[model samples]
Target: MQPRSPNTAVKFAHQVKHWRLAEDIRAFCAAARQSGAATDWTQWAENYAAAIDSLAAPLGMPPDPPAGQHDLRDYFRGDTYAHPWPFDKDGQWILADDGVDG
Candidate 1:
């Protein structure tokens, strides 16, 4: 998947794009190992992890954590306070034909 922002995440994605192939991957790992933990690789991992863990930090994203009762109702309900909504409208999501706003 691709990162949304042109910040640390985008920079990190570009850094690893060359490692897509297996042979290049081994070489990349070797380079990281040579650099040691106190290096870009570690920072990259931390930034990537933070981007992932954040509720909406990464724009294009992985699956959302499951929502249940007692989960933030605002997450599922729009500003209109619509009930039985299947998505959190406050985020960058839109509704289906049945719920579409535009």
Candidate 2:
């Protein structure tokens, strides 16, 4: 399912994309650590294959969430679950919190 507010969805997508990029970097670092500092022809080929087989890979299957991150839609939309954001007296998202004049 998608969010009711298009702006909110777009903002969330942007944030998620950034997170995905970071995850990709972390995955690459992990692979490098496993392979060691030096890389011969076989090691290079294996590393390349492993990189593409990672969850962050463009062609690899998606991986499960690290631990949390389940049921984030309600937290972000606030239409169903009471979002823990809007750390103000009023229950409203701030301008910097991806508020779109709602």
Q: Choose the strongest candidate by lDDT.
A: 2
lDDT of each: 0.49, 0.50
- State model 1's lDDT: 0.49
Whole-structure CA lDDT of model 2 = 0.50
Q: What is the lDDT of residue 38 in candidate 1?
A: 52
TM-scores of the models, in the given order? 0.20, 0.32
Q: Which ten residues in a row have the lowest lDDT in candidate 1?
A: 53-62
Once superposed on the true structure, which residue ranges of model 1 sit more than 4 Å away at CA? Answer: 1-36, 54-102
For 3-100, candidate 2 gives per-residue lDDT tens digits of: 64555566556656665665665566667667784346545655554554434434322333222224345455445334444333443334544645
By TM-score, how accurate is candidate 1? 0.20
- Kindly report the root-mean-square deviation of model 2 from the true structure over all alpha carbons: 14.1
Give me candidate 2's TM-score against the actual structure: 0.32
Error of 2 at 7 (Å): 1.6
Which parts of model 2 have CA positions greater than 4 angstroms off? 1-4, 38-102
Model 1: which residue pairs collide? Answer: none
